[model samples]
Target: MTIQRLEVSNPEFTPNNTQMVTVHSSHLKRRHDINFYNVNASGQNLPVIILLHGVYGNSWVWMNLGGIDKAYEKVKAELNIPEFILAMPSDGGRLDGSAYLPSLNAGNYEKWIVEDVIDACKQTLDSVTHNSHFYISGLSMGGYGALRLGAKYPNLFNGISAHSAITKLADMAHFVETPLSEYQCEHSSEADVMYWLKKNHHQLPKIRFDCGQDDVLYESNLQFEKQLKDAQIPYLFEQFSGGHEWAYWHLHVQKTVKFFADIEQSL
Candidate 1:
């Protein structure tokens, strides 16, 4: 893993005010090196939250959005919290273009986040250890990525929240009557997303799903909520006045941080 200092700014943070570090995933055998953002406290050790972004974005989206501090300013202040870090890794996929599924080009993003990226962060960052837990969340494509990661790596993440995410790729394929483009090659089969759910279903983490009423993905998200309900999964769900845009996501990001902070204290 490689680390470098980055100049970042937003409504809530500036370069000096927040420690912005770039993370490079070094899987020696792999062809590509993934990039991600690490927003951390100035000193001491604290629990970390692995903040996954959507398909079309890199790790810098969180810092670009408002910095982690701005999103969770009120909650952190009100709770008198200990230091925490946000791990944002570029999932090595197209930005705002591809869905974060295992594609022919991007390889298996699930493994990249669950193993490779986490491993790199643990090695590169002193505060991050193998046992350090994470609270994960995302918006749109990111939301889908978060859900997939949390469900797949229950032991790694304590909880997860999604804002306007694509909950089910299989459902979307069925909805559109088309297989995922990347999974459409002659010998390639569609990703068994449901199989992933069933196999790891027993290890599911605390889940949360929310979306804008006017978002195009609203119906898809609603179907996912039903699957959770039918499966007796415990989660928090909310609907707000907006669409699948940055405005809603910016506010929703705060809610995610609060959720993480709350869960960390309980542990």
Candidate 2:
């Protein structure tokens, strides 16, 4: 993939040891932003966590709205978790969201995140490398992207976690005004999470997901959990007492950080 342009800020000037990067992606044929966080600037060969944002949000929402950076620090210090480089990229800037899917109308947002975003992190951060383990996580629509992409490309990611995800493409209607017809792909099953999960069940990595009990998508999440069990696929499912809001995500993101850290420690 071609990187037409790249810009990174000095860590000293940015908060939470964060560095912002703008990458000109060949897949999207447009420039997109990635917000990176490396607690120890000089640390090398650290694992990477790619966080995805939901509808009506961009890369900055992970830190600015959800306070993931703060949660990362708290989790690392409290749990003695290993250092991880956090990479949060935009969902290709479609209307309210791109759904992080490869669409006929919109650009190839799936490739933008699965391929370009990872390459941008390696090119911009000294701590990330080809050998670094990658984990994927997201909230809402992003949760759908994380689960689908992570399962579809098991070799690229070591673990997956999603929060209040839209279990099916049709569920997108609950949040976006974009026509669900636009998300249609060549294969009908391409938009289904269970399709990927079952297709790669033998080699799928550690998977976990959760939803606030009061969240609109809670029932769907429960149905997904049952599907996983029926298919005999391994996964972790949790239900928390909250709603589909930033407060719920912010409070629980630390669990995702810890979850990744635990996987790293096991490895």
Candidate 3:
């Protein structure tokens, strides 16, 4: 598919002082619609941490639930975390979420995230340039996307984090119509985490993931943790009293930023 020139809308400010939203037209695949809400950290070449939202969610999910401004205030005041721009984009595919992967029916969504979304950000944000840093994080399906992409293209990210994420494809049967067999089709997959980690595990960026104690995905997350552990992978994993809801994600999202801040400063 010919990657058409990207079209990024002007930034739209929200009632909150810390954020703005940008909707862009993608030419990479058939689902040309993409949007994100950004919390500008007020500096040039800031870390571009792209956040993918879970199913039935959009760019404003973070801003609406946790408030980026509030998170920044807490993290900076308490953790002394460095400032960074937050890019929360809508995956905008199947109702169950595109899984942030290219699919047989959903053309090239992986490229849409790994490539076009970044391109759109560079064009829309003046402070963001080609050399600006990058990071990834998400909730649930978004978390799965973050890890999958971070594992597949380790060189592009400085760190990765997810909250109550779906780690295995089999876990999605309860929520999505697409079966695991179909999801595994070569035409649908560009960097399925199942295969990508083998090639890129050594280079996978600083990783962290956590699920809530009361959440359904908690067990799978544990299994995923073991997969990483058995592979000799190092990560920060924790479980807290909560479930797979916005409350859980909002509470821990700051840790994700703090984690990324450490990685960014270390390098």
Candidate 4:
């Protein structure tokens, strides 16, 4: 999709500090809209947070779910979080999602997240840049991407959080046609979260992930946590009473933002 400048007249939002913009992605061969928010745009020494969406969803999920306003209102007024910019991007993948992977066969979705998304943020907002403190979080599929990316590029982020994330590569078999082994091996170091984290242990970022007790991915999350514990990789995991729905993600996203805030304090 070609992205062009336009006015946002959608009555669905109240418009606090949010905006809709487009950034071109060479990897995806298209320009896509990004749901962006700059909390105190003129405020100095602010950090940046990137939120990824799950399957069958787009960046608007954050807004539609009301996490955006809550994060802005709470992070500033209530929580001790520092000033930060939040960006939500549509992963430009057809069907369900890209799983934030790059493949010659499946197109370059990883670059869309790691490269295009970052570049767009810096260019679109004056307060963000390569040197700004960075963090990532997502729901379900987005959660998988956030954790994978945190390990893949620890230097780019201070921390990473995931909710109801898919920890194994094979769990995505039903969404795409490619084999899990082949997909993970394409254009990246490793696909499996545990495998990638172990291989890049030295570059891992501050990590934490939690899943709903009744979610289908609960067992997968447990297995992933076990792997991390067995390997002695320090992280935080929590189980709350909910399912794999927006109600669960929306409530827990507040915790994720607070988690990032904690990491900021440590640094």
Candidate 3: list runs displaced more than 4 Å. 1-40, 177-184, 187-194
**lDDT (C-alpha) at residue 235 in model 1:** 79
Please give, for residues 81-190, the per-residue lDDT of candidate 1 as tens digits. 65566667675654343444555554555566676666655655667676677777777766777887677667778888888887765444432333456434223323
Please write out the lDDT profile of model 3 over residues 1-267, one tens digit for every residue.
233554545436334334343333343334344444444456788778888888777776777775654775788789766667777767855556678777665455677778777776677677788888899998888889998988888988889998988987677775777666656546444545646766687788888989998999989999888887887777889899999888778779888888888988898
Off by over 4 Å in 2: none
lDDT of 3 at 179: 62
lDDT of 4 by residue, 181-243 (tens): 555444455566776788778878888899999988999999888889999998999999998
lDDT of 2: 0.89
lDDT of 3: 0.74
Candidate 4: misplaced stretches above 4 Å?
Answer: 1-14, 173-189
Q: lDDT for each of the candidates?
A: 0.63, 0.89, 0.74, 0.77
- Candidate 1 residue pairs that clash: 54-142, 56-95, 56-96
Best by TM-score: 2
Ranking by lDDT: 2, 4, 3, 1
Best by lDDT: 2
Please give the range of 10 consecutive residues that has the lowest summed lDDT in model 1: 2-11
Candidate 1: residue 99 lDDT (0-100)? 48
